[model samples]
Every structure is written in C-alpha cells, then in structure tokens.
Target: MAGHDMLRSISRTFKLPEELFSGMPRIEINGDEEVTVENHKGILMYEDEQIQINGGNAVVQIRGRGLRLCTMTRTILTIRGYITGVEFLR
Candidate 1:
C-alpha cells in the first residue's frame, strides 16, 4: 500500500486520536553519529548507537544502545536513534 495509506491504517488500528496523527514524525540521521526524530506526538531519543527493525502494529523499533519514547497525546510516538528501518504492520 501507499505510505500514507499504510500510516492511516496503522493509526486506525491503534485507535489513535485524530489530532495525534496530524503531523508526521520527522526522522533525521546524522552520518554515524546519532539519529533525531521529531514532530511526533511521542518522542524517543538514544545516543551513540544504531537501530534496526522488522515490523510492528503501533510500535517503532530501534536497534541502538537503548531508546527513549515520549508521547505527548498518549497516541503519537517519536523515536530517535540509529534507525535502520521503519515498518507499519497489522
């Protein structure tokens, strides 16, 4: 499916509020340093590490040292790390 469609589907399945998913998460990678994720209802940050993922329903995975996730609306999630993959699944 399309990326937007996929996001919508995941949002619906997770029962996320409308306002929560209004903005897409901003994922930034800085060479081999650190990754930054912003604009999400929730935020997760990790330092000096790598991230990898397979898939999930409403969870974003990171394969670094560790991670910090914060949710502003208790719905949206922001994850920051050495992200390698982001998958939205059922």
Candidate 2:
C-alpha cells in the first residue's frame, strides 16, 4: 500500500478524526450559500462556473453562479454565494 493509504488505515484504526491528524480534505457546507474547506492544499482553478481546490487525496470542485471566495488561509478556504454543486475528483 502507498504511504497515504497506510496513514489512512492507521488514522481509522485509532478511532481518530482523520482531519485532525491527516492532511485529508474536509468540507463543510452551510446551506447553499457558504462553504468551508479544511486542509486545502491550494486553489487550482477559480471561475464563476467552477472552482477547484487541491487537497491531500482528492481535489474539491465547486460549481455555481456568482461564486466568490470569502477567504483563504494556509489550511482553510471559505467560499460564499450560490452553491449549485460540489464534487470530489481523485
């Protein structure tokens, strides 16, 4: 197994929330207006139609109209506006 997979196994075995110890991405959506992404590596793409964020194991893509970036930090990203869809691309 890859190192990442092994880490995941260990994280699960310990009954720990992976997001705390792992770099795996965690996303929180508040209704259809706001979104918070944790452990985001970086923003790969951004536009009105779509926004792509790089995470540890997967990339998060948000689709919507009038999408706006509320804030971004080294480990977090916040988005605001009408969120039409969300997807994970591995």
Candidate 3:
C-alpha cells in the first residue's frame, strides 16, 4: 500500500481524526464553481486547462476552464472556476 494509505489505516485503527496524520490531502468542493485543498505542498504546474499541486505521495491535479488560483497559502489552496475533474498522479 502507499504510505498515505498505511497512515490512514493506522489512523482509522486508532480512532483518530484522519487529518491528524496530515499525509493525505483534504479536498472540498463547494459546488462545481469552487474547490479547496489542504496540506498541498506547492504548485507544480498551472494553466487554464490544468493546475497541478504537490501532495505527499502524488500530485493533485484540477482540470477545467478559466481555472484560476483565486487564493493560496502554505497549507491551503482556494480555486475558482469550473472544476471539471480532480485527480492524483504519481
């Protein structure tokens, strides 16, 4: 299993909040117009068609039209536009 998966399983077994470990990325979509991601390392690639950010074991990618950063900080990213797809790539 991936490192993050193992950490998640352990967190579950211990009855701990999954976010405690902070290895897995947390994503929240407020409708298709906005999306938020937590614990992302940084942005690797960005464009209207795609935005890729560094996560622990993989790169988190968001796809859509008129994609914009909107807002970003050390631990979180707020994106605005039509979020067509979300994925992770190694």
Candidate 4:
C-alpha cells in the first residue's frame, strides 16, 4: 500500500504543467520578462530587472519566452515578443 501511495504521488507530480515550474505567469509577462501582468487588468512595469504589475480588468496569456509590452490600457494592449500564438477568447 505504501508503494502504491508513492506511485500516486509521483504520478501527480507529472500532472503539473511545465509552465508552473518555469515561473510562467498565469496571465502574462511584459517586455519579455521586463514586467509581469495578471489576467485581471493588472499592469507590470519593468525597468532593469525588476517587475511591477498593476491590477485592473484585463486578461493576459503568456506562452514561450521573451515579451515586451510597450503600452497597455483599457480595451487596448500593445506588446512585442517572439510571439508564437495569440488569441482573444471573448
């Protein structure tokens, strides 16, 4: 029974998404890691290596690496990165 429990734990570990360990934001990372923004209208300001995010009413999805958000406002978001894919689900 103990072995079974251990196996279950191990299996659960694999179930975790790769992004979770990579510090991948559940929302989005701005300026290619320069900043981080949440999905709920949150903004992040990045200068040097520090990151800041402001909360509001917006959703961001980040996938892959390197993102630069030049400007973001209500209903409009500007970003630059090696964008692989982007979609608006609303």
Candidate 5:
C-alpha cells in the first residue's frame, strides 16, 4: 500500500492521469451505443446482451442489446451496441 501511496503522491505532483499509476481500468462511454475500456486484462464473457471484462482488481460487466466486440487489443477493448447498463465488480 505504501508503494501505491508514493505513486499517488507523484501523480498528483506531476498532474498526471491517475490511471497511469494505478492499475485500474479506464472506461469511456460514447452515448448509449459504444463503450471503450483501457488497461483491461481480458474478456470474461461475451454474448448478444452482456459482456464482461477482467479489469485486474475488478470486473467490468456491460449489459445491452445486440452487443458486439468492435475492437480488442492487449490493453484496450471496444464494444458497440445499445448499452443499457455498466457495472464494476471488485
């Protein structure tokens, strides 16, 4: 925990994005039709109405309609559909 505290202090001092220091997921939502996730570990589930992503310390669950994996890479993922909800489970 001390290491994390030190990183947090450095981040604040440098005015850097917190996610650059914290191993946490960064999520971006574009209206109700698209979602992007960064710093994600991997996908846990994929379906027409639900998608689950492993986010290291937590899991990102997305629920929607006609869900599709638009893009995915080592650390980034993009989902497209009529997104109804998003949840983070730790």
Candidate 6:
C-alpha cells in the first residue's frame, strides 16, 4: 500500500482521528467570543480587527472586534474577542 494509505490504516486500527495524521486544521468556536485552532501551521497576520492563520489545506481568516490572542502553542492557538466571522480560503 502507499505510504499515506498505510498510515491511514494504522490510524483507523488504533481508533485515532484522521485529522491527527492528516495535518488538517481543527477549529472550535465558542458562542461569538472565542475560537480555538488546532494543528495550525502558523499565524500569517494579526491585528485588533482581523487575524489570518496558515491552515495546512486552507487559510483561516478571522474577523472580529477587540481581538486578542489568549493562548498560543506550536500547533494550537486560541483567539478571544467579539468574533464576527470565520472563513476558510483555499
């Protein structure tokens, strides 16, 4: 089997989510106040009104007011503020 296919098979056998092995970004939003992104590549832009994240397959765009970074790690980040919109651009 192909390398990727093999990895996928292994992941399934272990009951692991595919995103963990696929490098895809996972996003979670809470109400209109916060957003958490996992497996993100990096931050492309940051501001009080907007932020851009480098997702593996797409660019994550966040627009808001009073935006601030609440937490950040190598693969995960949390944004807090009055979130107005979220978009994924390919």
Highest TM-score among the candidates is held by which one? 2
Candidate 2 lDDT by residue in tens digits, 10-72: 889999888876677899999999999999999999997789999767889999988999899
lDDT of 5 by residue, 1-90 (tens): 678778878988999997789677899999999999999999999999999999877799999999999999999999999999999987
What clash pairs does model 1 have?
A: 42-70, 42-78, 43-70, 44-68, 44-78, 51-63, 51-82, 52-63
TM-score of each: 0.34, 0.89, 0.88, 0.29, 0.86, 0.80
The alpha-carbon deviation from the true structure for residue 49 of candidate 2, after best TM-score superposition, in angstroms, is 1.9
lDDT of 6 by residue, 1-90 (tens): 366567778888999997787666889999999999999999999999999999977799999999999999998999999999999987
Ranking of candidates on TM-score, top first: 2, 3, 5, 6, 1, 4
Better of 2 and 5 by lDDT: 5
Candidate 4 residue lDDT tens string, 31-87: 443333333345445432222443322223433345566676653445555554433
Worst 10 residues of 4 by lDDT: 49-58
TM-score for candidate 2, residues paired by index:
0.89
Report per-prediction Cα RMSD to one decimal: 8.5, 1.4, 1.7, 12.0, 1.7, 3.2
Report clash pairs, candidate 5. Answer: none
User: Clashing residue pairs in candidate 3, if any?
Assistant: none
Q: How well does model 1 score by local distance difference test?
A: 0.44
Give the best candidate by lDDT.
Answer: 5
lDDT (10s digit) by residue, model 1, range 1-90: 476676677778899853345344445556533444444333333344533222222333455544443333343334443445444333
**Candidate 2 deviates by what RMSD?**
1.4
The reply for model 6, stretches above 4 Å from the true place, is: 1-16
Rank all candidate structures by their lDDT, best first, as comma-separated numbers: 5, 6, 2, 3, 1, 4
Candidate 5 worst ten-residue window by lDDT = 1-10
lDDT (C-alpha) at residue 37 in model 2: 97
Instruction: Write down the lDDT of every candidate, Cα atoms only.
Output: 0.44, 0.89, 0.88, 0.43, 0.92, 0.91
Better of 5 and 6 by TM-score: 5
lDDT of 5: 0.92
Q: How much is the lDDT of residue 6 in candidate 6?
A: 75
The TM-score that candidate 4 achieves is 0.29
Error of 3 at 31 (Å): 1.1
